[model samples]
Target: MTFSLLARCPETGRFGMVISSSSPAVAARCAHARAGVGVAASQNITDPALGPALLDALARGRSAPEAMAEVTAIAPHIQYRQLLCVDAAGRTAHWSGERILGTWGVAEGDGAVAGGNLLAHDGVPAAMVAGFAAARGDLGDRLVAALRAGRDAGGEAGPVHSAGLLMVDAASWPVASLRCDWLDQGCPIEAVARAWDVYAPQMAAYVQRAMDPREAPSYGVPGDE
Candidate 1:
């Protein structure tokens, strides 16, 4: 059982996703994004390849709906997977197979989409979309807010053990990839949010370091000084 949101920031051309699940390492399997391409989630019976396949289609100039159609047409065992996508153009698409788990729901908003299976209520996804629409700051902030809203609306049918946040901008790689693979005691979403709070202020510095180390900020460690 899992819930996820995919979004694009029109102001900055960034794509992001936040996902949580009752399983371990949920993001490693379900979360997918590519800079200048799109973001995707492939869950419910979990076809990890589908995430990449959807992005590949988008990178090749397919719209979100077209990519979903193409992948579902060729993907094996398609009846068991739930898929979501948002292209660079901010167009969104999703597919919930006939065999998707219980109480599944999906909602789309301006430049964003949310979905979940085995959910506490059908409104969870809609709550996430609304939260994203209302929040401010960077794409990561809005994504985490959406995730919190889903939790408040009653998240998965059971306790979620893993959560993740992924984001990409103009870089060839993700600018943010934070994960709580497994949390035995507390909520993984909260864990991920705390991690984001710590990471967000430093995110730009890390990008600068990658792009042009000489102009990057100090590492604040003794050796760097």
Candidate 2:
């Protein structure tokens, strides 16, 4: 019922994800990431705890794959979980349990990785990998390209209702955290893309301001307009 891709660009050191699902608002439940921390996506009976767990483990100096492997190895119901990760250093990892139902798999290469379960076909993850490899841009753009490829390859087994994307830089703030919980009407994936357009610049401004206080405008001034 869901498919997701998480990645980090080596040259830019940017991290992001593109996820879609027949389930409504898959974004709120599946996507979890923090600036200067790491990226995580857990779906198909999502374990929200995994978000913080993965990050904490990474913060403890574990590599992305090691953290993910440690976390997944002991999950009470490991067979049902599908998760992916890319730490701040650009390491990548993913898992699709063998006991999972219907078209479950994951592919990792270079600076990117994608995972899915209950997909429309087996080609989705591969298409996503190819898209990421072919994309020539920042991490966020490469993530979008991979998502588009998955969708073009044929998304989930049924209709999509919601989608989301998340990305964070090494700094304390984000460049974008675009999420659309309900998109049963319009194309959810495209809606997410549009939201990214609307929010990217603003988030960038916020990140920039946080990075350099001089770039931020002073609110209370004698001649403030």
Please tell me which predicted candidate would have the highest TM-score against the true structure. 1
CA lDDT of each prediction against the hidden true structure: 0.97, 0.79
Global local distance difference test of model 2:
0.79
C-alpha TM-score for every candidate: 0.99, 0.88
How many clashes (backbone N, Cα, C below 3 Å) per candidate? 0, 0
RMSD (CA, angstroms), candidate 2? 3.0
Give the range where candidate 2 is weakest over 10 consecutive residues by summed lDDT. 216-225
Candidate with best lDDT: 1
Tens-digit lDDT string for candidate 2 (27-115): 78888777766788888778778766787788888899899888987778878788888887878887777677787767887767788
Clashing pairs in 2: none
Q: Which stretches of candidate 2 lie over 4 Å from their true place?
A: 210-214, 217-225
